[model samples]
Target: MPRRVLPLTDVQIRNAKPREKTYSLTDGHGLYIEIMPSGSKLWRMKFPQRGRGDNRLSFGAYPVVTLQEAREKRLATQRLLLQGIDPGRYRDDKKRLAAEKGSNTFEKVAREWHGNKVPTWSERTATNTLRRLELDIFPEIGRLPIHEVRHRDLIDALRKIESRGAHEVAHRIMAVCKQIFSYGIQIGLLERNIAADMKDVLKTVRPSHFAAIDTDELPDFLAALRRNESRMLKPTLICLRLMMLIFVRTSELIETPWSEIDLEKGEWVIPWQRMKRGKLTVNPDTTNHHVCLSRQALALLRELHAITGGGTYLFPNQRDHKKPLSNNAILKSLERMGYKGKMTGHGFRALAMTTIKERLGYRHEVIDRQLAHAPPDKLSSAYDRAQYLAERKVMMQAWADYLDSL
Candidate 1:
């Protein structure tokens, strides 16, 4: 026989007194109110589980939760149980989701993602990435809950940037936001990457290559460089000539630490960390890029060492010896020499590649290897770093001699 417990009334609950021990007043269907010895009242529920003893759940303290509200909670919990869901677990998940939503703001999650990526990025890249977010993005949707940020919200923010005529900047910011959204998904704070499909949404920006001059123009360019040398700083002049000799990227050249050089061996082994695509600071399988120094290059380095020998960087900033020269310094120097739109520091790479192939008759692969570019065949990307080492040494010296001949 089942026992029938009458439904509780507000008056009955108000008149109830606490006993020496806790006592429960049932309103049936597993819902009841417990009167504690301390005179505090709480609502509780008991439900049956198939292979286990009955489980109980708390509906919070009474007076805060009225009888009607407690009944509503009881009905909701009963529905979960009927669907084979555990009410306690459901409630816990609900609480966890609410806490996550409150804590994972877009800015907070983006900053966390940025921190996790700092190790893989150059110091300049890391700084510029965060600065772009702070200046352009955070002010727009920084405080929004990450999960709640929709596609339209992201487009609206990116559109605002595009409207400013900074199409490249807008594109870069959108890419960064997409990465952040993916990170949010990885961390369980977001469900979808809303910014994934926005690749062509912004204005179409024509790809621009670094300005380079044809090999025949090298003679005139050299003449201009010589005429402008008196107006250029001594270090800047040396940097320009070294750039033409080595033909490395401006960042790689300007940021060179003296320790990376081996004047005794006539080699400069740039560690993988300094390489643009370095995935790790210390990698065993991926050897560093070796620049074979020519007689011309060695002489210039000796001249540079006389000035900056005691410093850390080969091209230390004029005002701050401890810091490297600005990446823009070479560009500014070239612009001053009247080569603003025609040539760039990066243009030297193109110039060297073409002249060596045409004049010195070196294979493209050998020249590309010296240029520190991956092999064209995807499978051969991990080829030995010393592949064609002897040929590359000969090619580098020949290229330097060709440049001096001009």
Candidate 2:
């Protein structure tokens, strides 16, 4: 049998004085307030653990937690006990989950993901990726607990980017966020990737190729480029000419370190790490991309070297020579040359591929190897293992001679 303890009144609680030793005043059941010698009152509960024994839980302090709130909490804890749950353990688990959610914010997880992937990415790639997230995605939902973030929240964030007419950027940011969430799930910070299904909801970005001029447009394009040379920086002018001659990817051209170029040997050995899909080697013999610089290209390099020879990048940024030129530098220069919408920095690759194949009379395989096109089938894969060094060296010189003739 249990003794009948009367529920305490607010009046009695307020008037209660602390004794020499800490003491409790019960409000029936197991709910009570402990008064310390320092006159601080704390709410607490005592409950049986069925098979284990009794355990106590501190609800909170007096006035702040209040009498009514403590009763509600005691009832909740007792309810859990009746259902064979440990109130203290349940409370601890909830608190732990809350703390974890606070620490596992979207921004925190995203930064962690970025840090982990930075080693594998180039300096330019790493910088742009983090800057994109910081400017776009982080501003919207970066503070939200990743686990609490739903697909709708993500859609809302992406909608803001779409509102700005950055459809392609929106698509890219969504992909980055998907990878971020996937990484969260991988490390047990989240149970699911909230951003997985968001792609279908975003605006459909139509596939578009890099804008390039046909072979016949080369003369007019060259004339415009020469005319714009006075308005452009000397390095930019030289870079454009080299791009025309080499026709490598814009990134490959702009990010070229001087060490990669051997002017005397007339070769530019772009390391495998610098190339796109570089993991898939061009041939079994080597992974480094070897470019045979034609005499015209070498002359241009020597001329540019006299000006920017001491610096790292051949096409160092005009404002900051310590770094490579901005990715937009070439495109903006092309735009200045009055070829906006008609030609892109990337367009040179297409123009060269077309001209070299049609005009040079080179076989498909030979030109394709020069272009570093990924192997399509196992047969081509085997073909990829062939460096075609001797033929490629001759072909590259001919290509340059042909461009000079143009």
Candidate 3:
């Protein structure tokens, strides 16, 4: 038969005095009060492990945890023992879980997610992503645990960003937050993304179109571009003209490196690292993007090459020769040319896309492919990049001729 032990009373515990050394007074059933030499009282419980013998667990200090509470905790520990669980090990697990939760703040998780993601992106993309978090999200609710992020919390953060007139940044930040929360869910750090429900909650902003000139404005635009009295530098004028002849985006144009262009082969390869790929794609992020160089485009490159050919970049920043030209270089140049709200550097691509489709009668598929638009799937994008290289060369020459004629 098991021996029965009596419970302790508060009066008895409070009346207990400290001795020269620590001494324990049993309340029975694994509960006891230890009176220390310093007159402090501590509540402790000696519980049994399945095969690991006895271990001590703390209920807290005396008076703060009354005898009744200590008894209740002792009973709970007994129940755990009866269920074949070790109270000490269980407590250790709880402590570990708490530590993990403490470290799993929204900012920490988002940065971790960002770190894993930026390897597949361009330097500009990686920099912009981190800048968004630092400027927008981190100051608001970054320190909170991932699960503690409410929809209103994210909405409030993004709305603050939107109020500052950074609408596109707000949009991109929300998309990134959704991805981070989804990542937390995938990695077992969160239950459900409260931020997920906010997918459609952001204010629908009308797409901001860049200032692009019409097709008919091109003849005057070209004539103004080539005028001897033009304020632009010789290298910049050639760059502005080449910007129209190629299907490349203005950003890619500004950062064109000498290594990526092969004049001998009449090809310019925009590495996948520079392509506009979102984080969700399963496609190989490093796919080679080919740009068919037209004869006019080649001639312009050759001419510009004589000037900047010795440098690493085709269009080098005059102030910082080692770096690509500032993204605003061409845009500002156009602004000075009385086309501030009329024509943009990127307007050239739209001009080509519109003209090639409407006037030249090229297929949309061919135009989009030449523009390096990622197809819907990995297989299709792969096939598209390599397909119609020959056809693209012919189309590119005709397109260049059309621009020169204007």
Candidate 4:
């Protein structure tokens, strides 16, 4: 017959070293503590497995797990065994469920959604979307299970953006929420997107109108911009001039990279991803076509290059050489030049429309293509590459020369 073991006191266990020590206790329970070569001590409960010979269940480490705590844990496992359950299997199942639950959290789904959509967005757009999520969504429903998110919870979260008087941003946040929820549905994390049904709760507001400079005053404004002396002020003036000359969106100009320009070809190839219309509509041939550069525009780029070319962006932020100039940098310069409320960054688009229509006598199609406006005809639009290379070259030079004459 095997010798029975006895329970050891805390004092006896503490003195026990590098050897297998066993104690047969009074309650038909056997206590065994093992001291490893590293001098670390472990407590184990050795009990009979009804069908099997014998098994050991590790209670815990010594010191960190007190004697009382280890005994309590041992008793709990014993009770489970008495109820015909395997404590080890039960613990493993609980851990597996917890991991699955964590993976289904709203934040996890949102991150996955962001990862999928980021490749389709420009660097700037991706940055802005993540920033918005970090600021707004992450704090509220980020940890909640995706399936449990309600419309009211999403509305309350978006209301924070609305409260800031950023109605447009609120709308954008709603779109982001919808996208994330939709992704959850597609991935089988949620049965349906609650954001899809919450659109009616949001208030509709008119788009804010931009205040543009009167067409007659553009000459004086152009002249003033050319003569401005502030080191920081000149590049923005040139950027504004280019925006007006090409009628491309202000965002395109601000984020312009040096690699996108081809001086020999006299074209600035705006990638489809960077264009206002997303990448799907971009024609490979059209997207790579150059915006014709005039002598004056070329001269301006040369001069600006002398100052900012050492960096990656054409117009880098003064404080951080890595980042492009702030989106409002040009608008702010216009305000400093006393054009506040009279002209905005977007005002340049209107100015170009008016100039091409009233002053230059260009066709609407030519003007719209130069502006990169979406084509009106579906079939012709598919075929139309907006071949404005020759016309734009002439128009840009004339516009620059006109600015010089101002």
Candidate 5:
């Protein structure tokens, strides 16, 4: 039979330890302290492992853990055991579950999304998108399960941005939510996207009218750009002029690599991935299709290359050599040039479209193809792969000549 009240004084334990080597001192309760070889003591509780003979649970080291504290820990475990729970297994299971849940958190998923999507986006696009997520989405629902995010919850979260009178930000948040939820769906974390059905709830505004500077204003704008003092401003202004002359998206402009530009051939070949329609739909034959450069565009590129050709990007950010300039850099330059309300980066597209269609009388098909607009017929899209190289070359040269004339 076990000793019911096996209390022994500290001196008694110290004296008897050399002979027995180990001894237990029990309070009247279930708590007991074991004295060991190195004069170290530990608290332990004796209990039966159901259907097994006997088991012991070590509460903690003694001295650091007083007798009272050991008794409390033992009583808590005993209470759990009495309630038909195995304290050891219960604690282990809780820890395992907590770890699993942590792995599946929104922050973890956002990180995964970043890893998968960053490579596909331009450096600026990836950085700005991540900044938005960190500032807006992560702070609110970043720890919550992606599947558990409801439509109302997402709408309410974006509503906070709406409350700040940022309708554009609200739209951006919705787009990001859609992308994240779609990613979650693809990975099987969610059955259906809650963000998919939220489109109708968010009202769409009519496209705002922006005034594109005409040919008459081009000379003054170019003069302003040339006269700008900032080291970072000139390349961006040249890029803006190139964008107007060539009429490609700012992303396409900023992400242009030197390897893709054939200075001798007078061409710029944007890859299928960087193309506006993405690679899948663009015909394989036209994969390496080239953009014909004007004399002015070529001269600008030559000068720009002399400065930045050492870098991978044609227009690397001033602050970070590894990164391209921000998409807004050109627009911001225009803003500083007192053209904020009158023109924008996108206004270049409108100016080109209007000039090509209304002023120059270029065929709609030619203009559309140059602008990388989608074709109507899938078969023609696959087969009729024309880069409008000859016509675009002439148009670009004439457009540059017009700017020079201005």
Candidate 6:
């Protein structure tokens, strides 16, 4: 007959001491506290192997892997043993499966790929890319294994996006799919990029131009913007004026932090971190954009500073001082001024680009560089940054004075 074993209590386990030789205090049915000469106590379980000799598994050290938890592990191991499985091997297999699941899921790989790819991407591009991937890609196939993704699965998702009048978004999604699959191949997770075969899988899209005010309408529009009483926030009105003077994208204007400006230097330096141009993240120092401040622009900044100087942002959110002004604030303000369809917030760039070239007679390269049009390559782009600083500063003052003259 087999000997009956008793379970170990906490007191018994705690009272255990070490000696020169290692020894064990058995709890019951294979669970014991093994006391080492170094005064370390480890909880170990000894069980019979499947139709073979004895096998042992470490539950963990005492106190850290507590008495109750150790017993639970022992019970779980015994359950596996009853099924004629090796408890250690079963646990190891489970661990392997978990690790594989962690590294092989589409979300995991996609995030990893994004991290690798965005070192050079502008803050906007980086943010938008991740946001789109999370919203569109992650929901559909992010949980599945990368290898399990099929062309049809992607086509279906793209089709749904296209159905909602987002043909361009669908194309971008397909491109992301191809890139991710290619990355997976490099990492040995996929054999071939199924996304490579996804051309003509989405609807063709036409380029849409942002509605801009005609160059001839500047006087009326500026007058309308200055007197617009519908906009509740004074800062919103000032922001619209600044956008016209600086002619930056609405995003660049609204998101401007006070640190980026230099009222004394007569310059507002839009850090590479703020601009929509990509590759600034990789080499941030090379892309800081310079906007020469005219006296009128400076006057506006000084006025705005008095109101918002306490906060980090030039146009801090009314409710939350930490955040910048909302993107919609400018658009809605335009809408309120009855320029909703006639002139969007982005229209300022087009207006400035055209007028700076035709009316101001500045070089196209100078105007384009000031407008922050991204160059063809990152190296060329970085080289192009502030190349015409002296010329641009002159152009900036002229443009501002011209606005004042009108």
Candidate whose lDDT is highest? 1
Once fitted onto the true fold, the runs of candidate 1 whose alpha carbons sit more than 4 angstroms away are 1-77, 81-96, 277-285, 376-387
**Model 1 residue pairs with clashes:** none
TM-score of every prediction relative to native:
0.75, 0.79, 0.79, 0.66, 0.62, 0.66
The deviation in Å at residue 96 for candidate 2 is 2.7
Off by over 4 Å in 5: 1-130, 145-153, 175-204, 207-211, 214-234, 279-286, 377-387
Tens digit per residue, CA lDDT, model 2, 139-228:
888999888888888898888888999999989989999999999899887888878876488879998999999989988988888788
TM-score winner between 1 and 4, please give it: 1
The candidates, ranked best first by lDDT, are 1, 2, 6, 3, 5, 4
Compose the digit string of candidate 3's lDDT tens values, residues 204-309. Answer: 8788777787777878887767663368776787788788888588778878889898878877888876666533245545666678788888998999989999
Worst 10-residue stretch by lDDT in candidate 1? Answer: 278-287
RMSD of each: 6.0, 4.9, 4.2, 9.4, 9.2, 13.3
Q: Clashing residue pairs, candidate 3?
A: none
lDDT of 2: 0.84
In model 2, pairs of residues that clash are: none
**Could you tell which candidate, 1 or 3, scores higher by TM-score?**
3
User: Compared with the true structure, what per-residue lDDT tens digits does model 1 show for residues 1-406?
Assistant: 8877899998888789999999999988999999999999999999987678798999988889999999999999999999999888898899998998888999999999999999877677899999999998899889999998877888888989999999999999999999999999998887899899887789998899899988899999899999999998888899999988888878889999999887888789988767765644443225478888889999999888888878899999988888999967888988988889899889999988998889789998988887877555534655534468888788878888988888
Looking at model 4, the pairs that clash are 5-23, 5-24, 6-23, 6-24, 7-24, 267-290, 268-291
How much lDDT does candidate 5 score? 0.75
Report the backbone clash tally of model 4: 7
Higher-scoring candidate on lDDT, 5 or 6: 6
lDDT of each: 0.87, 0.84, 0.83, 0.74, 0.75, 0.83
Q: In model 2, which regions exceed 4 Å deviation?
A: 1-45, 49-86, 187-190, 279-286, 376-387
Using TM-score as the yardstick, the better of models 2 and 4 is 2
- Candidate 3's C-alpha runs over 4 A off are 1-6, 10-26, 35-39, 49-53, 145-153, 208-210, 223-229, 259-281, 284-296, 360-366, 374-406
